[model samples]
Target: MIGDAWLWVAVEWSPPSYGLPFTDQEFDTPTTVALVVAAVVKAAFLWLILRAPAPGPMDRRTKALRRLLYLTVAYDLVLWYPLALLLDTVVAAFDLALWTSLNVLFLLVIRWRSRALRATAGTMFALELAGMADALLDELDLPELGSNDAVGFVLALGGAAAIVLTVVGQRRDGRWSRGTLVAGWAFVGSFALMISVVALADMLFSGGLVEGIALDALGLVPAVWLAATARELPTDIGPADRPPARRRELRVAMAAVALLPIVALVHPEQSAHHSFTGASPPCYDQPHFGDLKPSERDAAFLCQARIRYSGVPPIFPDTLPDQAVLAYGRALCRAKDREEEREILTRAGSERPDSGMDPWDLVYVCPEVVGATRPELLRSAEEQKAANDAYIAEANARCRDPWPRTKGVAQATANYFLFVDGDPGYLVQDPGDKAAEQAAGLAMDRVYDDDTLIGVGGSAVLVGHVEDVSDLCLTVKAFRAAPPRRVAGWDYVNEVPIVSRSGQLTVPEMDGGDVGAGAPMPNLAIRGKGRYRLRVYVRADDSGEQHLVVVFPGASRKRLQLKP
Candidate 1:
């Protein structure tokens, strides 16, 4: 009952911006049915967690195991609640409070003779509630006692211990139902199997994609199996859901459980989202990645995968699962830059109402976790969308009417290089190699995501003006059959390879470093959409006269030649 109810909770929670289909769980629109279900489930969870084992032959052994589970759960619950409250995870605090209240009530109501059993049972109830709460935290990204391997191992061991207690009790009572046995063993099997695969994903770091799927399958199958078994379980069941001792089918079930690991091994190495786990401890004072179940980690990354800065600077080697918010802020909004950046950083420091923290944190942790402290360093969801959308619209307009606009030539000292794609167009072609993508030829595109070969896989040039870059106007015009001869007047200097996938090239493709407070250039492109041997030329100081012109088509062309 608790499992089924908790599953509903997972389905209902929806975080802001990354909300699920449903916007709220029980809180926002707490219907009578929801309230009723919540109360009953909470009660059921409490009862199951706290109730001590029925008096039986193995009571002593089972009692010892439950004690271990209880003590650990109690210790962690005490530590987790304050953080949960600060983070607005009221649900977590409520759970701890209810568990405490129940423990107090049980101690008072039960006779002193049975006080030991009641306390034991109360601890058990807390564990079950913790499991239910975990489902919510995973779905909602709430801060709490995170689900990790140690917890999983303990849970599986608990399940195994439950099976033993059930079997001993059922045989002693002589009415072990087959359904109970099957369900109990299956729980132990699936629980252990799921936990084992998660451990493997952790140990085999890069296999996230394949291993992640297997882990999900392992989690879901067990949930369903337990639900069905619980619904059909007979009267004698239940403290541990033990099955009959003499059933021959028991061997088959255990054997099946033994074979389950193979399924995980055969799947792809990791979860689909990351295809690999991000390094643990991605930063200081951060939770370890292991705290989240593999699926939860994948989901969390998916929620935060948007790259804020146009290009992530290479300095911060951090990867996904790190503070998704502050990813590029350190690179994009450093205070050491021109006055614009420095002023913003300084202003943010003065404005931050917090006691005292790194003012630069405003940039580093964009979409700050605690709240939207991003004054300007980071783009709020609204700003990010607006900026990207605006960029796309302008880019589209240019790609359509691509004639070189009559803008003043970038002064003699242009950016480091005006990299154009077509390297693969004139070189080898391999999709996996970031360098060889242009071989696929240019395909016009409207959408780009560092994927789409048409947008990626190209070449670059050390575009220069005389000593720096001889830009009368650096341009390329496509020639289907062949281009015209090199225009006269300009002296041909050297030949360099070029690749234009999407048949588009942009000028002053600044390396960013050399790009001073120059003209705020559009991040769009020029229309040289294919491979070419761009013949470099320089017009002698014709006294800066002759209306400097860099013409194409009047230039020779040939079908892209790939190096053998």
Candidate 2:
């Protein structure tokens, strides 16, 4: 199965479509047949053991060994059934490593007295450790192991040596006939062959599917061979025949060997390398957020693709960056499969609505942490939906007429509104905010005393009123702090248009009655909900400069009757 999959991946699965050809053909019949065969073989192996003369009053040591043997087989079954018949994840990639570990552990236990067997365990353990070392290097962003094939080649040579030693050492022991020794060594040799085949297959067909039926059928070959050989071993053992002194060494060696492969194959690095940073379908060249790092963007793409395609669940690093998680949520929201998209997105977060409110507008009002806003604390999708529904319901109950979004920030009943303008480049130009607090306080005080003032806030420039206009917007553009020569000490950009409620456009005069030409903002009609314009009017005097605040009308979609 591994061989076929590897072949398919290399020849058939190419870039932009690195997956097996889905035939819609199920492997039910073949899988069932393989399972039935394995069951019969297992039952017979158990029958042979139970039917044997109880080792002539089995010793405690013998009983323990028998228990361990049973556990080995049981564990194999536990992992194999689901994997062979129903597994669908990338976990299948580690099947070879897991099987080899289990087999080596079993062999080490049963054949502890043989020096040759111990040597084989050591070699395999070392080879597995090298694989793990390579994985570790990759995770650390270090140079990768120069050649995976080099490790495989070394392991194959070691396996051959192990087989030869197994035969020679078993023969010297004289525990059984030459036939038995050769048969056991043949099993060892077959295991070695299996490892080589699996490795080569992976190299050939990296990410394609194999014939499930053939795969399952082939899996049974080792189990049947192992069982058949085990059933034939003699039931009796003498006290001297068991090597107690060597058991501890064998156990330690095998335990270490078994654990290395699990660590290498199941580590987080194994799952994260297959992300779609460059791909178009899974990830676009220009992502939703282009500023993200390659790793962050790739994580986002893979996170969404796994959910969309029902691919293997990716193992993420424990300490994923905050931006990366946000990116993943955004990508997940773009999935075409609405059901899965919602399921994954809601689990992460609701995709942040593109409010289009410029960050420059809010920086003056919010001098601290203006760019640090994150949606990590948003409520679950269901709760958010409920909140939205409740707000809409309450709004409907209060107002008889439907609120048209085109009305911008205007309310149905309110006649007066409050607005304030501050230094457009205050965040960038005067990040120290030497005069921001006083200016904002003065403007806020004006609104607090007035009844017509619905809401008052400061913005850098007028962004035309529109649907999804948020109060805060963050731009990466650099702010130039260069001040006008006439203004002195502080930077002043330009004059801004002041639109009357009756739709008249005029520039507000500065402190010297100088009508400075202002830059054109988004021209928006002064409907009740239209965008409000605020311009900082700088007045030069002997005591430096002061900005005259003019109040325009600005309101948010949400309304509250503070005075009425």
Candidate 3:
């Protein structure tokens, strides 16, 4: 329950911008190393502290150390763990709080009861066993393990019973040996059950037993600690004569010990965002236009193309302009037919604008010739009508479906299909609609913790200037090269070219141009028959040394080449 609550809080409060830059493998190394080191240090400290001779009557240093350890352990289990749980839950809204809280609570109970520490440890071991069972079930994608509510109720009742038994047994005989023994055996039995479940799951599912083993190891820690400390009990002692100073020292030591493992678990290279400039390989300093060797020029062109088209700085060693130009040139060279050459040349010509070229003329000539071959690429007026009909059908079906089961499913399914199918144009045919949908989706997705469906909408505002619509076409084409996989969920859209320009390519304010009241032209285009193409129609007054800016959400921009 706490885990669920924490997950809710995390999902609601966390920003969408924060994400780990490295892959799981890349991030695991430092975290694993840190955890290992911390664990070793903690174990060493615990051993040394336990091995130290009992203070005869009293020793101040021992008392101080014990107090520190107690405080540290208390802080970690009671304060730090809870806080971390809260933070994590708030950030992702995943149900991890229950696991974190239970772990800490078990540790605390063990610390409070020296004689029954073994029992407490054993109970924790049992919980770990249950945790392993749960993990295995999840890995296997098994049916819900009972219901969450049922599981929570059972756990609560079990905890209450254990507490009652401990309190009653302790008060009656000043020792809970029988109860402890029973609890220990029960816990061990639970562990055995979990092992069986894991083994079965491994056979059925093929893998995931390793996770169960890791969980089991985690569960055994308290039991090991209890066993190591069990031999030193003074039998006739009562609560009145218990050493407060010694208790404090033990707590402090345990805390210090715990800190070691946590430190080791965190990855060192976990960055929220990656800077592409740092990752890309070296490239030429200048625009090597027709002077360099073909290969070198190709490399430089790729770098420029990436820079100009991506709007983001280079993530790889190539430039955007060079890449676009080389690609266009290659297409031209390989053309076997007159029609193919025209199409390829049209695509190549659309990339860079001549210094004195009229923006409107360029937009008119390029998109018409280049985009003509791929009429199907453009979402037709009729197709838009069809999409509207499909969306309505889906929405109506959603209402008819059972509650919760299909409430969010239709929208999610549509978004997923859109992403998987690599067609942002389906979501919106016009630039303004595209921008609006993208913004709205982003906002809504954050609120619902539905990153999977909401991430497909493309940004509307261009980040950099383009010489002509051809540049814009190329930029958009590159952006559409690879759509995100719906199942995997969208993290980043790959190969989106950002277009940067030497001069400004500003759009007129709403009142200043024909774009304000009238419907905007759809930016959708398709590649066909070895050539790039799109259809372009423009209002008369909308003319200039136009710059088409393509911006990816988190990437840099680059320029596309207009001609070979």
Which numbered prediction scores highest in TM-score against the true structure? 2
Q: What is the alpha-carbon lDDT of model 2 when measured against the actual structure? A: 0.38
Error of 1 at 175 (Å): 28
Q: Of models 2 and 3, which has the larger lDDT?
A: 2
Candidate 1 residues 191-235, lDDT tens each?
666656556756764532233323333333333322322232232
Ranked candidates (TM-score, high to low):
2, 1, 3
| Least accurate 10 contiguous residues by lDDT in model 3 | 409-418
lDDT of 1 at 553: 23
Alpha carbon lDDT of each predicted model:
0.35, 0.38, 0.33
User: Residue-wise lDDT of candidate 2 within 1-564, one digit each (tens)?
Assistant: 454344333332222133434434332444335445544544554453343323245445444444544444544545554455543322333444444554454454344465555566566555544554454455544444425677656645654555455455445444445544655565565667567567677565434334332343344434433333343333433344346797677567666665664455443532433333222243223233223433444344344433222332322222343345444444443444556555654555333222211232222222233335623222344655566556444532432211232232211211011122432211111112344345344434544343333123332122121112111111111011211223333233222322233342222212221122112122132343233434233323342223322224443322222212
Candidate 3 residue-wise lDDT, 242-272, digit = tens: 3666756544544433333333323243221
What clash count does candidate 3 reach?
Answer: 73
Candidate structures ordered by lDDT, highest first: 2, 1, 3
Number of the top-ranking candidate, with lDDT as the measure: 2
* Superposition error at 269 for model 2 (Å): 18
All-Cα superposition RMSD per candidate:
18.8, 18.7, 26.7
